[model samples]
Target: MDARRDVFQAIADPTRRAIIGMIAQKPVNVNTIAEQFDVSRQAISLHLKILAECGLLNIKQLGRERLCEAKLEKLNEVHEWVAQYHKLWTGRLHALKNFVEQEALQPRQANTDNKKKTKNIHKPKK
Candidate 1:
């Protein structure tokens, strides 16, 4: 798979998602991260490998133990994509808001016009 696709695929799993959240909160070793999940340490190691390959996790070799930290730079692509859709929805919502306001005012205007018409029709000749 391509680099971006690999990253997206790796993140699609709930276990991987939880791992990312945990690492973002604080850097920890594979064993520490594995404790939080029911899976084996080896499975966690595999997930870590995918995350590291995807550039989402930074792995540092601190002597014998490797620590993992959330890299987050690649995540900006997700932010930018969502921001584009946010603008489109915001515009649609604004249009809906304007339509609702105009619709609400229309009844009041019709009532006022009816009142004026009645006053003009029933008035005694001066």
Candidate 2:
């Protein structure tokens, strides 16, 4: 059985996420990717390795250089996960809006009723 690593764990590091973003635009060699970061080449290599293991990247050897390419399909998992919460928060916000509108209307309605009661009390009986 192929054990799939969690894409979230691989992308948890800021460097790894940056690396993914960099390669997403186009394929790049390890040295090119390393140059963009403050970290050492070894550190960048480790990040690349984690990303590959998580299925977020595809590394290939072309001539002497190892090229890293992004396999963005893996990100669909992350998107699906976030979409659930997006829907939940949207529902919660709609409920909050309805509550606020109802609260606003209640005060106006109560004030109108109170005004009518006050006018009735002050009026002389017919």
Candidate 3:
């Protein structure tokens, strides 16, 4: 219900996406995540905050360290939205393949018909 952050907008950044990928494998410390990027720790922290706001991440206080963990179920929103278009694109691409294949076969069939006509015309009348 937090309109301030949206999952899609949270994931739209390359750095944020990389951070998500890293943590999705396993929980990682905020410092460790910051080390992987050229950006400032503050910048990375902002990205982490946005991710947390959108429910895509869960930040844990592990003693003195903050750990970022992936709550990847949130990604199901993206997956479901994309799946709707996946079916449409799959059907369209299949239809395109069928059309191209049929067009390719058409020329070969025409050539065969031409060859039959030429053969008939060249045949010596008995």
Candidate 4:
């Protein structure tokens, strides 16, 4: 898979997202991360590998332990892409606001226009 695709796929999983969220709080070892999940250590390792490959996680070895930290800067790709639409959305929202204000200024019909008086209808002899 492409690098961007791998990153997108890695983040698509809720467990992986939670792992990233946790690491964003602080750098932690493999075992610490594994403990947070119900899956096996090996499974967590695989998820970490995918995250690292996507540049969303940074792994460094300190003595015998590998510390995984979130590399959230890579999210700029997504941020930049979404920002392009932000301007367009802003314009559309402004237009919608103007439209709503204009509509609200229109005159409203009286409620009695919708109500029928019993005297207006023909009545059967009792």
Q: Model 3, residue 96: what's the lDDT?
A: 100
Model 3 C-alpha lDDT per residue in residues 1-126, reported as the tens digit of each score: 468778899889999899999999899999999999999999999999999999989999989999999999989999999999999999999999999999999999999999999999999999
Clashing pairs in 3: none
Q: Find the number of clashing residue pairs for candidate 3.
A: 0
> Which pairs clash in the backbone of model 2?
none
Q: TM-scores across all candidates? A: 0.78, 0.91, 0.85, 0.73
Ranking by lDDT: 3, 2, 1, 4
lDDT at position 20, candidate 2: 90
* Candidate 1 lDDT by residue in tens digits, 1-126: 245555667668999989989989888887789899998888988888888888899889899988999997888877787899999999999999999999999999999999999999999999
Please provide, for model 2 over 13-124, each residue's C-alpha lDDT reduced to its tens digit, 9 standing for 90 to 100.
9999998989998999999999999988899888888899889899999999999999989889999999999999999999999999999999999999999999999999
Error of 3 at 72 (Å): 0.5
Model 1 error, position 118 (Å):
5.8
Q: What's the C-alpha lDDT at position 109 in model 2? A: 99
Model 4, stretches more than 4 Å misplaced? Answer: 1-6, 108-126
Candidate 2, residue 103: lDDT:
100
Pick out the ten consecutive residues of candidate 2 with the lowest summed lDDT.
Answer: 1-10
- Predicted structure with the largest TM-score when compared to the true one: 2
RMSD of each: 2.8, 2.0, 2.3, 6.3
Per-residue lDDT for 115 in model 4? 40
Candidate 4 or 3, higher lDDT: 3
- Better candidate by TM-score, 3 or 4: 3
- Model 2 residue-pair collision total: 0
